[model samples]
Target: MGTIVVTGGTGTLGRHVTERLREAGREVRVVSRHSAPYAVDLRDGRGLDAALAGAGTVVHCATTPSGGDERAARRLIDAAGRAGVAHLVYISIVGVDRVPFGYYRTKLAVEGLVERSGLGWTILRTTQFHDLVLRVLQGAARLPLLLPVPAGVPDQPVEVREVAAHLAELALGEPAGRVPDMGGPEVRTLEDLAEAYLRASGRRRRVVRVPLVGASYRAFRAGGHLARDRAVGTGTFEDHLRRHFAPGARG
Candidate 1:
């Protein structure tokens, strides 16, 4: 294995991917706009060639959630192609093609770019993460009165560590275009996740189900973010809540 480059190496899942790659004794280089020594901005293409120069495989874990996911992906694809990287491994969300949500749409577009980029590539689609669900409810927990949540948006949240381990393995192997999707062991609604958070934290906030609006909600309701058949995760939502959020769990 040659030098392995990890984009967004400082971010949530990216951090785990980087750590796992390092743990596996791969020569790991992190690409990021700040902090990371390579300091490459995927959208801008600045420092990209230098960062990816000797990379045998480039693991793309970077995402611009506020927007620019497609653009950044395109930029990376172009740069990687130029750098002669052997394989491009991308971490994608499950149901990106089926979902009409903006982020998912962008992800689908990026997938197309990778397919046509004329480089060996592998895209690993995964379901939501446990931290994401907790973050949503944590934001709601700050509210004084009631905890507002989507009525029935179902989610299969997985552990970041598991997903990262999978990504690292993928990065080290031959490119397998659009690999099998991964998801959590348990499927739960947004409301259920929120209530669990509340209970774990010993908060008694009244639960309020608010009907979501727009095509995003429609896509969520269409089960666009689930991989029900592939429960690749070993941890449960309750296990995470109890370990990290439940009162005195650390003890």
Candidate 2:
């Protein structure tokens, strides 16, 4: 097989993916807008012609949070075809099709594109990441005195490294095409997550659970982004908090 190319190599998940691939002694090529040997503007499709050349498998971890998930997927798909890349692996959130959000809609569109890209493709619909959860908690902590959390909004926040390892393993194998979703070991509510953050960090703030009402929150409350049966990740929210908030933890 040729080199394994990793898109979005600068992002949290992509970094771990590249690390795992290199540890396995695989010839890895990293494609990113910056901070990688193979710099490629995935949106404009620039540099991809050279970045994907001789690539056996291309892991699609790149994302445009603001918008343009579909544009990037189309660009990469065309590039992969021209480069003769074999497999295309994508990282997606669970329940993208079931959720009624713009981002989820865009992701579902990309999933469709990958399915019909005529290449061996695998899309792993994992739950939210611990990093994102932490960021939300941190933002909530900025409240004057109370951290407001949406009640009944549950999440299965898996660690990035776990997802990255899974992606690397999938990249080495034949395309499985919409394999089982990956999720954290346990399901938790947003309130529980906020409480954990406060407990771990010893923050002097109250966690207020507010009732959720919007469509997005309704989907989250209904477990739209959960894979209850496929809790493949071992790490838990408490475990992640310990790393940063344990006694003598990082300052």
Candidate 3:
């Protein structure tokens, strides 16, 4: 295997993917605009070719949450094509095809690009991360009195480490077009997750279910972003929370 380049190697998910690849004894190179093994922005064509030098596979993990994900993805694909890279692995979110959100729209567009790029590719669509749920809980803590959750919406948050490991395995093998969708072991509601977190931390808080009124809400309530049949994570929300509050445990 030639050098495998991981774009966005410095990000939350990217870091885990990078570490997994390194542990497998693969020659891994991180591509980023900042302090990576190779300094290359996906949007910068000039730097991309240099970074792709001798790289047999490219894991396109870099993303822009705003709206430029498709443009960046296109640039990366073109560069990879020019450099004759063998495989391109893309990380995307579940229900990106059904969601009307801008970020998901961009991801869908990039998936289209990969399908037509003629290079071996694999797209892994995963559910929201456990960290995202924790972030929501932490942000709602400021309200002082209520834990607001979208009514009737369910989430199955996966561990970032599991997603990273799956990606690494894909990078090491022949491209398997659109691998099975991955999610946490259990299905849960937003309010229940929030309550679990509060209880684990010993914080007394009232949980409230607020009706979401938009396309995003509709999709979420319909479980559009979750993988019900293909759930594949080892850690549960409670397990993750216990580890988080372990050192600070007082009993």
Query: Could you give candidate 2's per-residue lDDT for residues 126-206 as a string of tens digits?
Result: 988988999889998998899998887888889888999999999999989998999999898888889889888788788
Best by lDDT: 2
RMSD to the native, candidate 2? 1.6
TM-score per prediction, in order, is 0.94, 0.95, 0.93
lDDT per residue for candidate 3 within 59-122, as digits (tens), equals 9889878666777888888888888899999999999988787788888889999989989999
Residue 245 lDDT in model 3? 85
By lDDT rank, best first, the candidates go 2, 1, 3
Better of 2 and 3 by lDDT: 2
Give the per-residue lDDT digits (tens) of candidate 1, residues 1-251: 67998999988899999999899888889888895568876777888888988789999999887888788888888888888899999988998888787788888889889989999999999998888888888888888979998887889999988999999999989999999999999888888888888888888898898897888888888787899999979988888887785465552
Backbone N/Cα/C clashes per model: 0, 0, 0
Q: In model 3, how large is the Cα lDDT of residue 93?
A: 91
Where is model 1 poorest over a 10-residue stretch in terms of lDDT?
A: 242-251
